[model samples]
Target: MLNVLVTGGNGQLGCEIREVAPEFADKLRLFFVTRENLNLESESEIETFISANQIQAIVNTAAYTAVDLAEKEPEKARSSNVVIPKLLAKIANRHKIKMLHVSTDFAFDGKSGKPYKEDDLTSPISIYGKTKEEGEREVLKELPKAIILRTSWVYSKYGNNFLKTIRRLGKERPELKIIYDQIGTPTWARDLARVILKMIQTKDLSGFYHYSNEGIASWYDFAKEILDLSNLKTKILPIETSEYPTPATRPTYSVLNKKKIKQTLEIEIPHWKDSLKVCLSELD
Candidate 1:
C-alpha cells in the first residue's frame, strides 16, 4: 500500500481528506497527524518523525493563516509558513517522496488586471503573503518533485472561514458590511482535497499550479449568495475596502489563472457558485 502522511489533519482540507481516505483504503495507507503529534516548530523532531516512518508521500496543509495577525507577529508566521515547510521539503527530497504544499492567493499583489498565472511576478503587500511566498521558494529549491497548489478564498463547514463567519454574523446582526472591491473565487476545501487526490493518482504531476473554483465574485456578491442560499433574513451592505480597515492589505483582484493546472492534470473544475450550493447543503 502507498503510505501518505497528512499534516494539519484538523484543518478544512485535512478534514475533507479524512472523509475521502476510506475510498482508497485498499491501495493507500493514510496517516493524519495534527500539530500536537508532529510539531513543525521543532526541526529536529520533524526530521526524526519523517525518517522513522515509512512515509511515501506528504500533504502539508498546516499554515499560519491569519493575514491580519501576521502583521503583528511576523516571527510566528514565518516559523509556521516558511521554516516548517523548508524543513519538510529537505526531508522529502532526501526520502524521494512526493510532497504537496498548499499556498494562498495573497502571494500576489493584486495589481495585475487579469487572473494571476503561475509564472506571474509576485509582490506581496502583507507579512502573511510574503512568508507564504518564501515558503514556496524554499520548497521548490529543496524538492523539485514537490507540488505547490495555490488557492484563494478557501471556505468550508468544518473550519473557521468566510462562509461560517458570514453565516454567524448574518444570524446575529441585521446588516453586514463586506468589501466589494476584492474579487476572487471561493474555493471549497472539499473540492480542493478531491483535486489533490486526483493529482496524486495522475502520473508526473508536479511544480507550482493554481486551483480555485471557476467564476469570479467579490466579497459582497459572495455574502449575498450565502444569505440567499441559507434562507437567512439578513441584509448585506456592499462597501469599499476603506470602510472596514484591516491590518493586512488584501489584493483587489486575486483570482488565479487555473488553466495550467486543469490542462496539465486533465481535471474538470466546478464553478464557485455551484460548489457553494453543495457546501451549503452539506452544512444544512
Candidate 2:
C-alpha cells in the first residue's frame, strides 16, 4: 500500500478525505496531520515526519484561507500559502514522492467574461489570491511533477462555510440578503476529495487542473438552494456586490471550466444543485 500524508486534517476537504479513505484502503494508507499534530513551520520537522512514516505521497491542503483577514496579515498568508508549499515541495522532491497541492479560483481577477481554462493567465486581485498563486509557482519550481488543483466556493458539512452559515442564519432570521453579483460554482468537498484520490492513483498525472461541481450560481442562488434543501422558511433577498463590502475584492465572475480535468480523468461531474442536495442530506 502507498503511504500518503494529508495536511489540513481538520479542514473540510481533509475531513471528507478521511471519510472516504476506507474505500481506498486496499491501495492507500492515509496519514492525516493538523497543525496541532505537526509543526509545519519547521522544515526539519516535516522532513523527519516524512522519513519516519515512509510516506510516498503528500497532499498539501492546509492553507491560510482567511480571505479578509489575510489582507491585514499578508506575512502570515505568505507563510502558509507560499513558504509552506515550497518547503513541502522541496521535501517531496528530495524523497521523489508524489505531491498534490490545493489552490483557489481567486487566482484570477474575475474580469474574464468567459470561463477560465487551465492555461488562463492569473491576475489575483487580493492578498489571499496573490499568495495562493505564488504558492502554485513555488511548488512547480521545486517539484515540477507536483499536481495543483484549483477549485471555487468549497463547502461541506464540516467547518464554517457558506452553506453552514446560510443554514444557521436562515434558521435565526426570516429574511436574509446575499450577494447576487459574484458568480461561481459551489464544490462539494466530498466530490473534490474523491477526485483527489483518483488523481493520486493516476500515473504521470502532474500539472495545474480545475475542479468544481458542474453548473454555476451566485451567492444568492446558493443561499436560496441551501434554505430550500433544508426546508427552512427563510426568505433570501438578492443584493449587488456594492451593497456588501469586504476587505478583499471578489471576482464578479470566477467560474472555472472543468473540461481538462473531465477529459483527463474521464469522469462526469455532478451539478452544483445535485451536490448541494447530497451535502444537505448529510447535514440532516
Looking at model 1, the pairs that clash are none
Per-residue error (Å), model 2, residue 3: 0.7
Report the lDDT tens digits of candidate 1 across residue range 1-284: 77788888999889988887887777777778898798876768866777677888888999999999999999999998999898889888988888999998999999997999999998999999999999999999999888999999999888789999999998999998889999999999988987877666566878889999999999999999999999998988899999999999999999999999888877889999999999999989
Q: Alpha-carbon error at 58 in model 2, in Å?
A: 0.5
Candidate 1 weakest lDDT stretch, 10 residues = 194-203
Query: Cα lDDT of all candidates, in order?
Result: 0.90, 0.95
Whole-model alpha-carbon lDDT for candidate 2 = 0.95
TM-score, candidate number 1: 0.96
On a 0 to 1 TM-score scale, where does candidate 2 land against the true structure? 0.99
Per-candidate TM-scores read: 0.96, 0.99
The alpha-carbon lDDT assigned to residue 111 of candidate 1 equals 90
Report per-prediction Cα RMSD to one decimal.
Answer: 1.3, 0.7
